[model samples]
Target: MEEKNMFCFQCEQTAGCTGCTGNTGVCGKKADTAQLQDELTGALIGLARAVDDTSAVSKKTWQTIIEGLFTTITNVSFDNAAIEDMIQKVRAEKDSLVGDCNKCQSPCGRTDEYDMQQLWNADEDIRSLKSLILFGIRGMAAYAYHAYVLNFEDPEVNQFFCEALFRIGYAESMDELLQTVLKVGEINLKCMALLDKANTQTYGTPEPTDVTLTVEKGPFIVVTGHDLKDLQLLLEQTNGKGINIYTHGEMLPAHAYPLLKKFPHLKGNFGTAWQNQQKEFDHIPAPILYTTNCLMPPKSSYIDRVFTTEVVAFPGTVHIDEQKDFTPVIEKALELGGYKEDQTFTGINGGTQVTTGFGHSAILSHADTVIEAVKSGAIRHFFLVAGCDGAKPGRNYYTEFVKQTPSDSIVLTLACGKFRFNDLNLGEIGGLPRLMDMGQCNDAYGAIQVAIALADAFGCSVNELPLSFVLSWYEQKAVCILLTLLHLGIKNIRLGPSLPAFLSPNILNFLVENYGIAPITTPEEDIKVLLKQ
Candidate 1:
C-alpha cells in the first residue's frame, strides 16, 4: 500500500473493488486532489476536537464542518484550490477554538490534527467501523448542509457532527467505534428529519407531477445535484430572462416541489442520471449548473458550460458564490441559445416522460385507499428500490428488478437510480402508478414515513410488513441511509451492485448475522427470496 500514491475506497466504483491506490482514482480524481481531501478531513477532525474540548459551538463552526465534509464527498470538489481553501478554513476554525495551542512547548497532544493515514492503515475491523462512521456522517453532512441552507439548524445534529469526527480520529477499540457507527445512523435519522422539515416547510410538500424529457428551444440552463434552495434561487434569478430551466440527475425531483414547479420556464428534465453526464452533456448548447455533488470531470467539449455552486467545485468551472447570483450561467445559456427546435429526449426505457413527487405526504394522502387495497389483496407487496446510480457494471440489475416486480406490488423509488426505470410506466394499481418516484436521495425520510405508517395501519412492525428493501448504493449518502434503515431495525435488505470495500470480513459478518444484510443476487432469485414466492 505504501507503494501507491493514494488510497480511497469511499465510493462503490473504487478500483478493483478494493481501494483506489494510484495517481488517480476511478472517479477521475488525481492523487494530489485526493491528498488535499485527506488533509481537509484531518483538519476537520482537528476542528471537531477543538469544539469538543472548548466552549459552546457557533453556527459558523458547524457550517464550516458541514461544508468541509460535503466538499470531500465523491465528485463534489475536484479543484485543488477549492479543497486547499477548505482545509485552511477548517484549520482556522480549529485555531479560533483552541487559540495559542501552537505556542505551548509542554503541549498536550489532545488538540492535534489527526493523520488520516493512520486511520487508512489501522486494523481492518477498526478501519471498517470508523469508515462507516466517517462515510455515514459525510452523507449526513450533505443533508445537514441542505437544511442549514434553508436556515434550519438542529443543535443535536451539529453537536453529533463534531462528536463523530472526534471519535473517528481517536477511537481505537472496535466496540467503541461500532457504537459510534450506530450512533451515526441514529443521529443521521434525526438530521434527515430536520432536513425534511426544512424542505417541506420552505418549499411546500412535494406533489406528484409528470416531468418531460424534452429540452425546449432557445436559452436554457440544466440544474443538477440535490439542492432545492439553489434550484429555487436559480429559478428566481432566471425568471422572465427568456431562458428555460431543466433538471438533471438528482435535481430531477425539483419538479415536484410546488414552489419550484410553479415557474413557467422551469421546463423539464434534461438527461439521465449523473453517471451519464459526460456523454449526455457533451456538446450540449446549455450551461449546466451543479449545486452539489455527482459532478464528473467535464470533458473539454462541454467544460466551458459547466457552472458549480456551494460545496461542489471543479477546476476552471464557473462557480456561483454565497450571493447565489447565476448571471454567468444565464449569460452562457443565452450565448449558446439552446436547441434550434424543441428536442424530445427519452429515458433509458424509451419513454418520453417520467413522473416524480409522490413524497410520503403525497403517497400517504390516499392512506385509506392503500390500506383497503392491501386488505382486498389488490396490492400484494411493496418494494423500496432506491439509492444512487453509478457507471459500475451489473447496475442493470435495478432496471431488471423493477421491471420484473409483480404487477400487484408497488415499487417505490427515489434518487438518481430511478433514471433506469422511472420512464417505464409500470401501469397502475388502484389508480396509483406502480412505479412511484419519491424525490431525491434525501427523500428516504419520506420512504421511512410511508413504511412506518403502513406498518401501523396494518398493526405490524415494519419488519413484519410486506415490505422489502432492495437498495442500490454508490456513495456516502447511500451509506447513511442504509445505516438509518439498520438503525430502525429493518432487516433482510439486499444491497448491491457491490458491497463497500471498506467493510472488513468481521464487520461484514456482523451485519449479515444480526441484520440479515446480504449482497444482491440475480433479480429473479432476489425477488423470489424477498417475496417468498
Candidate 2:
C-alpha cells in the first residue's frame, strides 16, 4: 500500500463536499482504517475467485464472504485487527477450496480472488459500470446477510453474489461490465424478494399500522438498523422486564409486523435518521442498541450507554455477542431510570402519529383504488422520495421536495433518509395518506412491487406511469437499490445530495444517456421537471 494520505469519495458527504483525500474521512475514518478496508476488499475478491467453479460451497465459505463484505461497508467495522482476522479467514477458506480442486483435476474455475484496484483505476466508463456492479452488489449483500441470519437463504441469490464478485475481479470490456451491472439488478431483485419472504414468513406480512410518537414512561431501550432478527431477539429478552423498546432508524418498520408489535412494551419510534443519533441520544436516559451499521461514533455522554451486537462495532462501546445476551444494555437502561413522567415527542412535520406497513402486499391489495384515484385525478403524481441519509446540507432538498409536493401527489419513501420528512403530515389524497413510509432500506423491495403493480394496473410501463424517483444516497446499500432500479429500465431519477465519487464521467454519462440519471437540482426545479414529465 502506498503510504500517502488516503482518498475516498464514495459517499454523499465527502470532505469539503468533494472527496476525502486526507488522513481521515469527513465522517472520521482514519488513514489506516481506509487501508484495512481496502485490504479486506482485496481479500474478499480473492475468496470469491477461490470458489469460482467449485462444485460445493461450505457454510464457512458463505459465512466468511458475508462477514468480509459487511466489514467493508462505510462505518461498520473500523478495527484493523478484526479486518485482518477476517482476511485470514478468507485466505484459509480459499486454500481449502484450492486443495479440494487440486485433487479433482477438472478445475471448475468457480472460485478465485480479485484485486479491487483494477476497478479503482479502470477506464472511466468501464470503472463506473463495474463500480455499479461491485458497490451495488455490496449493498445487496448486506440485506442477504440480514435475511440469512433469520434463517432465510436463496441459493440463486448467493450464487450470483459469488459470480458478481468474480467478474469484478476479472471482467475486461464495457459490454461485459455493463452486462454485469444489469445482472446485479437481476440478482438483487431476487435477494430483496428473498428478504421479503424471510421477513413476511418469519414475522407475518406487515399490516397498515399507526405508530405513535409518544414513548411510554419506564425503562426503555432504542434499537436501530435493518435487522429484524436482532429486534426479535431483543424483544424476546426484554419481555416482561418492565422495559419498553422503541424502534429507531431502519427499525421503524418493526412496528408494522404483527408478531413484533404484539409486545405491548414494543413502543413507537424514537429519533429520526442514523445521522442524527449523536444529537438524539444526548442525555437520553436509555440504552441504545445498534444491530447494524450507519452508526456514527458516539460521544462520551451516550457512549457508555451505546451497545453493539452482531457485526456492528465501535472501539470503546460495549458489544453484545452471539449469545444475544442484552443484559448489559438492559441493565444500563434500568440504571438510567428513563423519564419520570410520560413524554410526548412530535415528528419533523409535527404529526403526533405516522403510519407504516404499506408494503407490497398491502399496497398491491389497494391497487384498484390507487389506479382509480390516478384516473380520476385525485392522485396527480406519485413521488418515490427514498434513499440513504448523509451529513450534506443539500440533503434538506428531500424535506423541501416533500413539503412542496402538491396535495394531490402521494409521497412514498423508504430507507433511513425518509426520517427527514416521514414526520411531516402531508395529509391524504383520495383516502390514502399523502406520505407513506415503506419500511427499511430493503423495503425498497416493497416500493418496487408497488411501482410494478401500479404500472400493470394503468396499462403502462413503470417509467411511463406518473411516478418520479427523487433519491438521496449515502452508502453501498443505496448503490445496490439504484442499480436495481436501473436494471428494470426505470428512468428520469433525480439523485442527490451528491453523486458517488466512484462513478467516472464516462460511466455517469452512460447512466445519464441510457437511464436519465441526474443529480438533484433545487426542489422547486426538480418538482417542476417531475410534474412536467
Candidate 3:
C-alpha cells in the first residue's frame, strides 16, 4: 500500500490555493497528525451515523462527536496521541450502538466509517457542500463545547451535529447536501446563543471593562483561546499561589466577565494575536495555557513551559487531563517567576490599555442613548469589523478599514481579529465608546442581539439599520458565523483576508448573487462604498 501523507483544506492557509496536497499543512500540521485528524473526522462521521441509526444519542456520545470534529479543525490539536484517543472514543461509541462488525450476522454499511478520501474526491459541487457542512459543524462545536463546559447543552444543537455529520457521509445529491449546508448555519445560531447564555448566566453579563496591557512582576500565567471554564479553573488554582493570570488572544474578553475578573491576581492581557504568539512568547517567563483551537505549533524557545488543557495538546507540552487540576501549569508559572521589575506593554498601536466587555447586555443597556444619537445624526452608521485574525499579510486591511470608518459610526468588534485595531482609540459617541469590544467571536451572538435591538428600536430591518459587516476570517468559526448572517438575510457583507479556498466558484457566486457577499478591497474605496450605502 502507498504511504499516506495528508489531505486537509479546512482553513484559509491551505497550500496550492486549495488543499494541503503535500506532507504538511500551512499551519504547520505534520503529515501524520493531519492523517490522524482525517481518521478522527471519519470516525466521528461513522459515530454519527450510528447514533442516528439507533436513535439513542447519549450525552457522552454527543460530546464525543462534537469534540472530535472540533479537534480536527485547523490548529486545534497537533498531538497524535490526543487525536488517536478521540478516534477511539468515537469508535467505541459506534461499537456501543452496534456490537463488533465481525460478530454481527448482517453487516450493514449504513454506519460504516466512510473514508474521508471519498468526500475529498467526489464531484466538485457535492464536495463543496459536504465540506461546508463538515467545516461548519466543526466551528459550531467550539461554541457548544464552551457552553458544555459551563454545564449548558442544547439538545437541538447536539442532535444537529449528528444529523449534519451523517449527511456529510451519506447524503448523495447536491440538493440533499444543500439542506445540510444551510442547516449548519441555522443550527450554529442556536449554538452561539447557548454559549452567550452560558457565559452571561455563569460569569455575569460582561460589563464595559478597560484592560491594561501591563504585566506586573512576579509569577504569572498567560491563558489563551476561548474556554472560560479553563481560565476559571486556572484562576481558582493559582488564586493564593502568588501567580498572576493574564488573558491572551480570544481569552482577552474574559476580563470583562464579573466572575473572572474578581480574582485580584488575574492581571492584564499578554501578547497580540494567536499568529503573533511565536514571536511574542519568545523568552517569556510565563507558562501559557491553551484552552482551545487556533494554536500554532509551539516554537522550541517556550514550548517547555506551554501547557494545554481540554482538546488542545502539542506533543511535549504538559496537558491537563480530565481532572483539570492545572497544577502543572501553576508550577511552571511559579518556576518562571516572571520579570524582575514591573513591565508595561502596549498594543500594536502603542495604546497602553484597551476596552472590552461591551457584550449584548452592555450595548443594549445603552440602546436609548445609541438610538438617540443616531436620530440626532451624532452617529450615522454602525460597522461590525471583526472575525478571526491570521498571519496572512493583507489582514492589515481590517485595521485600515476601522480607521477609515466615519467619526459618527459606532464600531462593534469581537474575536481575536479585533486586535488588528482594538487599541486605535476611535473615541466615543453618545457617552458610549465608538469602538466597542463585544467579547470573543462567539459573542458574535452579542453583536447580533445588539443589532436586532437597534433595528427593533428604529422599527426597521437589521440590514436597513445603517449597519455593515466587514469581517476577516481565517478559520471555521468565521464560516459558521458568516453562514448564520446569511441565514438571517443580511446583505452586502464583506469578508477577507481572502475567502475560503474550499468555496467552489459556483458556491462563491451563489453567495455573492444571493447575499451580496464580496471580498474586501482597499479600505479607502471600501470604506467610502460602505459609508455611502
lDDT of 3 by residue, 91-203 (tens): 88899987676376887687888788998898888888898888899899989999998999999999999889888888898878877788788899999999988988999
Global lDDT of each model? Answer: 0.93, 0.84, 0.88
Q: Write the per-residue lDDT of candidate 2 for residues 1-533, one digit (tens) a residue.
A: 56767666666677765578789887777787877777777777777777775766887788778777877787776666666777788888888877766457676645544545666667777766776777787788798898889888887877777788777777787888788888888888889999999999999999889888898888999998888999998889889989999998888989999999888898898987888888989989999999888788888888889888777777888888889888899899899988899889887767777778888888778888888898899999999999888767888889999999998998998888887788787888767888888888899989998888888877789999889999989988898888899889999999998878777777788889999999999999999999998
TM match of model 1 to true structure: 0.99
**Residue 488 shift from truth in candidate 2, angstroms:** 0.5
Question: Each model's TM-score?
Answer: 0.99, 0.95, 0.98
Worst 10 residues of 2 by lDDT: 108-117
lDDT of 3: 0.88
Model 2, 424: alpha-carbon shift in Å?
A: 1.8
Give me the candidate number with maximum lDDT. Answer: 1
Cα lDDT tens digits for candidate 1, 141-171: 9999999999998999999999999999988
Error of 3 at 73 (Å): 1.3
What is the lDDT ranking, best to worst? 1, 3, 2
